[model samples]
Target: MIITESLDNKPAAVTLEPLPDGTTWLYLRKNAKQVEADTGDETPDAKPWQCETAIGKLGADRSGETADTINAKFDDWWTYAAAWAEDEPMPTVQEQINAIYDTLAVMMGV
Candidate 1:
């Protein structure tokens, strides 16, 4: 699968394929030209590999010496992103009780 999306306002592409056992393989290719100085260029010769592991589990960050390394970076970012997204306080005990009571009331047509 070729995912063409803009990240950080730059065009990015991610290619993913599935292994025989339902594992996904991901590849990040630099499809656009860049100044060599600014390039964290992924070696185009790198082959796709299964997306698993702490970093590889999400196929997010694609810059690293190896597939595993790249995925590891992604895992780090994902952890932060997930936590940031859910940065809310837990419900209080009374709030939880109220929710249960609300559900019970609906169940009893109250």
Candidate 2:
């Protein structure tokens, strides 16, 4: 099965391969358009990120898991894990506490 979506405005595709070793491998094709643009070629020759996610413990049935749902999960997981790369670093412990206090104070009209 193949799932394609526009990741960060670049065409990306994810290939789901069910392996014989009871593991499902997810392959990611990232920056597909960038490769073509950089090479000045219409054909994309980007090497896909193979075996990005492996599902071994998961049962055979992927209950109600569609391309959109899987993509969203991958997006959220990547966002949280790769925050340092594209966005501001996560807040410090003190900053988090202060923000929580500020929000509470505003809610309580303090």
Candidate 3:
């Protein structure tokens, strides 16, 4: 199953693949355009910046789980994984300017 979801308000592609062992693997890829540009992979199925983790085996009882239920579970796991990944948020404009100023100050031996 492949779905597009918002992570931190940014579009991300999430994929769920079932393994032979009954466990499922979940993958998340963000910024398709940037990833394609950076990797020079323009294929339609190109997966860049993809991260994956195994979701425990789905018991027989869960075989009839609805799409919404699966999505909810994925969201919960993804949220925790995202937090654990500790991806740095983009710096604000003011922060960028301060960084530049700090660099210049050091360059000029201030």
Candidate 4:
């Protein structure tokens, strides 16, 4: 089974294969989607990058409180992780995801 990770790099859709050792080999696949930036109620056009900023701690800033805030946030974090993976010293995949979740937890007060 293939897994598509979310913006936090949380792996999804896990699959397995039988190995000669009578053990199952686990496999994970990331759903790579073309990220599109938040158009802010406007139709986007003629932009190569979904986000305005390519390289940084996060791909985009989503400090806005809007109806599409969740979607925008997913894209923002997802793009940020992608960019961070491309260039810069980043934490482990698990760490990155944990950080995002932790932040969310704090924000949500859960």
lDDT per model, in order?
0.43, 0.46, 0.50, 0.41
Backbone clashes under 3 angstroms, per model: 2, 0, 0, 5
- Write down the TM-score of every candidate: 0.28, 0.31, 0.31, 0.22
Top-scoring candidate (lDDT): 3
What residue runs in model 2 are displaced by over 4 Å at the alpha carbon? 1-12, 34-66, 77-110
Alpha carbon deviation, residue 106, candidate 2 (Å): 74
Extract clashing residue pairs from model 1.
55-71, 55-72
Clashes by residue pair, model 2:
none
Expressed as tens digits, the lDDT of each residue in 1-110 for candidate 3 is 23333222233344555667654444545334323323355556544442333223344444554445556676665564455431366599999999999999999999
> Which RMSD does model 3 reach against the true structure?
14.0
Give the per-residue Cα lDDT of candidate 4 at 61: 33
Superposition error at 80 for model 3 (Å) = 3.6
TM-score preference between candidates 3 and 4, better one? 3
lDDT per residue for candidate 4 within 15-53, as digits (tens), equals: 334445444333333344445545565656422221122
Candidate 3 Cα lDDT to native: 0.50
Sort order, TM-score high to low: 3, 2, 1, 4
